[model samples]
Target: MTESNTITCEKFLPHHPAAVWKALTDPDLHARWWAAGDIRPVVGHRFTLDMGNFGSQPCEVTEVHDQRILAYRFAETTLNTTITWTLNPEGEGTRLVLTHTDFDLDSPMGRQAYDGMGRGWPHVLDRLEGVLGETPGFDEEP
Candidate 1:
């Protein structure tokens, strides 16, 4: 079977960019959507995302455009991939993009991860939108 080199998922969240930004940065809020990590937007910041049974994956912030984009080197010792999250204001909400790239498909681990993550990311994004929807005072323009 052919393995994937990257896992990309996009979703339109019915909340403002600020709200989605908060969900991406805040650990408590982020845990509700994705893995728990001290994921800040500042470049060079290092953190670990708890990938449940997959263990903690080390990550470093590689790029940041404030609330617009956040990219990082993910699972350096394992999957050795990069995960980027982009947020764009669209209509009355936010357009969120998740790109997981550089999977070493030649390796067994990579093939497993590529298959799993490809199926998993959509659920992750959906949960992100759900979390933001339930959050209070996240999208208000006050």
Candidate 2:
């Protein structure tokens, strides 16, 4: 679902939260699924994601709850938005929810990003699931 200032995408992955969390935090694995960056689970850590043609985006870790939650300020200057990942254990798999909020819909850049990301997040999550399927032991119970 997408709102004016927020885009939320949820997917059920047939993998453990630990595995899903690893894909979210591990730089190598993360790069394979999403953008490349020195992404860590530690709060206050700063990094930049190589967004292909969009250039590099600055991000700062704002919150981390182990495998449960990870929130960060994304595109600090240009977008000035927050991207949050939430993991919920469901059945034998994990329910991953991504919430991207704080878009300045009034601005041209913000509106464009909001529209683009709204359509892009699902594909990104699909890539994440594919990566998990390929990783050894990632699809197995921990």
Candidate 3:
């Protein structure tokens, strides 16, 4: 029952934008929360997110703005999705916006992929909040 071809997810971090940005770009912090290690956030770098019980994606760094924006390409699946992560300062914290473009809800596989993502992202964002010891400036459904 896929309705949209693309979806965007967002979370706000209760920390300095630079700090959250570092956690996002730095391999060490990313490994602590993202997935099975080996990732760097520099433009032109290649990385993989191995979901032990799910699947894997080989992603490549596409763009960066040094604590402001990050973009990447995931080329392991049928849909060539581009992921964009943006950070913006809000008062004393930061807002993170994640847009997974190129999702095709018109296909069976695409629908499955979209459903998987729907279940996966919030858990990681919650982990990110746990890592920061505070909830981000956003609300979630029960």
Candidate 4:
């Protein structure tokens, strides 16, 4: 049974907000965790995330708040969803909150994607944490 169309998750990384922010904005680091793309933290920056078998999805940066918040339009012509990543400084780490919303669950395609991504996001975030862990000097501050 499909519960909800949105995929929301929170990951507590032992890295500072600055590092987490870089991981999200930097394409190389972003690809290490998620899809490969030329993503930047500048609003209006358009990019594409190669989802392998899922094809290339067009994205446009809609909002950015330094290392605090990054929001963008994902899969413009396909999924037409909004993916927002929020970074919050917590004690000595960053609390990363991911909100992937606007899935047209009524359609089979949307349902499939929603279900698949719902399970996939946690693993993606795990990889992200792994990347940060292996970084030469990550989470060394804050």
Top candidate (lDDT): 2
Candidate RMSDs in Å, in order, are: 1.8, 1.9, 5.8, 1.8
lDDT of 4 by residue, 74-113 (tens): 9999899999999998999999999999999988988889
lDDT of 3 by residue, 1-142 (tens): 6566666778877688767776677666776777764666678888887767656778888998988999988754555788888998887778888887787777787778778887788788778767656434322211
In candidate 2, stretches whose alpha carbon ends up further than 4 angstroms from where it belongs are 1-3
TM-score of 2: 0.97
- For each candidate, give its TM-score against the true structure: 0.94, 0.97, 0.82, 0.95
Query: Where is model 1 poorest over a 10-residue stretch in terms of lDDT?
Result: 133-142
After superposition, candidate 3 runs with Cα above 4 Å error: 1-3, 75-77, 134-142
**CA shift at 81, candidate 3, in angstroms?**
1.2
The lDDT of each candidate is 0.88, 0.96, 0.74, 0.93
Error of 3 at 85 (Å): 0.8
lDDT of 3: 0.74
Model 4 vs. true fold: TM = 0.95
Clashing pairs in 1: none
In the range 61-95, model 2's lDDT, one tens digit per residue, is 99999999999999998999999999999999999
Looking at candidate 1, what is the lDDT of residue 44?
97
Between candidates 1 and 2, the lDDT winner: 2
Q: Would you list the rank order by TM-score, best first?
A: 2, 4, 1, 3
Which window of ten consecutive residues has the lowest lDDT sum in model 3? Answer: 133-142
Clashing pairs in 3: none
